[model samples]
Target: MLKKTLLAAGTAAALSFAGAAQADIIDLFTTDQNALILTDVGGPIFSQVSGANILGGFRDIGLQVFSDTGSPAARAIVEVSGGVFTFSNDNGIGGQATIQWDGGTDALDPGVLNTTGLGGVDLLAASADRFILDVLTADLGFPFQLRATDMLGGDFTISLTSAGPGTFEIPFAAFVGVDFSQIGSLSAVINTAGDTLALDLSVASIVTNQVPEPAVLSLLGLGLLGFGITSLRKTKTA
Candidate 1:
């Protein structure tokens, strides 16, 4: 009887530990405009554009004019429609543009992307996590480079091919080295080679495994020790 009790307790404890270490997936795009922090242009406003499901039936759009000499002064807009986001120059201006998603001050610190607002728990700082983006190109032959920069000044470049009308899942593993305690902002930039280079992006996220607390680990160890002691007592009696 004691052996059976110990076996059941051990099994339950192991299962609990496994459950505590599960991975979490966070959605990067949403109807909440506060979730995004944009710079280098006018209002990064949200509206119902003539596109498909960008997110919850609407998309965020913004326009900016660069006067950095020899560049077109037309208002270039970054718009999302039907889950697809496109960046193009309205006045045939060809230059560089940037878009960023800020987790918000309530969820993340200024210039920090830590796990504070992530369910009030801490995550493993050095886990092999992935930052995923669903993206494609408007021109099937135009190739462009997208750069992702983190708060700690870490830049990872992803070269996109134009063999795409269908959205492809691009997973960036460079986020594994990020400081989870002070995770900052996530931004993407593209330098247009011509007057127009339309790249569509959707569904950005970060997936990572959770870390168990020290108190939880102590409880697990105690449970195992109790089980072992009970099993030894049963063996002596038998």
Candidate 2:
């Protein structure tokens, strides 16, 4: 019954907010340790910190597709739930992960932080996860591409299926800083166990800065509905 209500609410919200330019993910990364994190752009602001780690296992082989717009068939957005953009990504031979965002306001934080280090990370020399980030655009509605962000700007695409079936990356962490101009402070963690991986955020520790549009609209609609319904009832009784 609750699920039904939420679905109806979401649909109604989508309708009222038609032409409100929805947000989509810009990138998703799944490691050999089987860990995944989705980065998105141009939508509503959303963020969560981990009170615990979310775990899951996946296959060793999959797809790598891209879309030009919001379509996964044309380019890559986010979310790595087994047959999305990176369908064969489970054990892809060569692939890349690209991410960037800026909702109407700041949405989810791109930074993933760690106090107790995660395993299998290709880390930086500072004892923290030092990722090589390159800004590709200021446009928030287009598809972002992931490539070999090497010194030579070489074309060394990553293949998840590198060596042994269980072989994976190293131990390290990633800190994706969201734009400070909008909303700020989103820390995350990525871990791996065998063929699967996990994402842990510092949710219970930080302040939630953004609210999804659907929730806000629902509250407003309910207020209006109650006012109308009460007026009708009062007139009937009178």
Q: Provide TM-scores for the models.
A: 0.39, 0.19
Error of 2 at 59 (Å): 21
Compared with the true structure, the alpha-carbon lDDT of candidate 2 equals: 0.20
> In candidate 1, how many Å is residue 15 off?
34
Each model's lDDT comes to 0.33, 0.20
lDDT of 1: 0.33
Identify the runs in model 1 with alpha carbons over 4 angstroms from their true place.
Answer: 1-28, 32-75, 81-84, 105-128, 140-163, 169-171, 174-182, 192-238
Worst 10-residue stretch by lDDT in candidate 2?
Answer: 1-10
Model 2 Cα shift for residue 53 (angstroms): 1.2
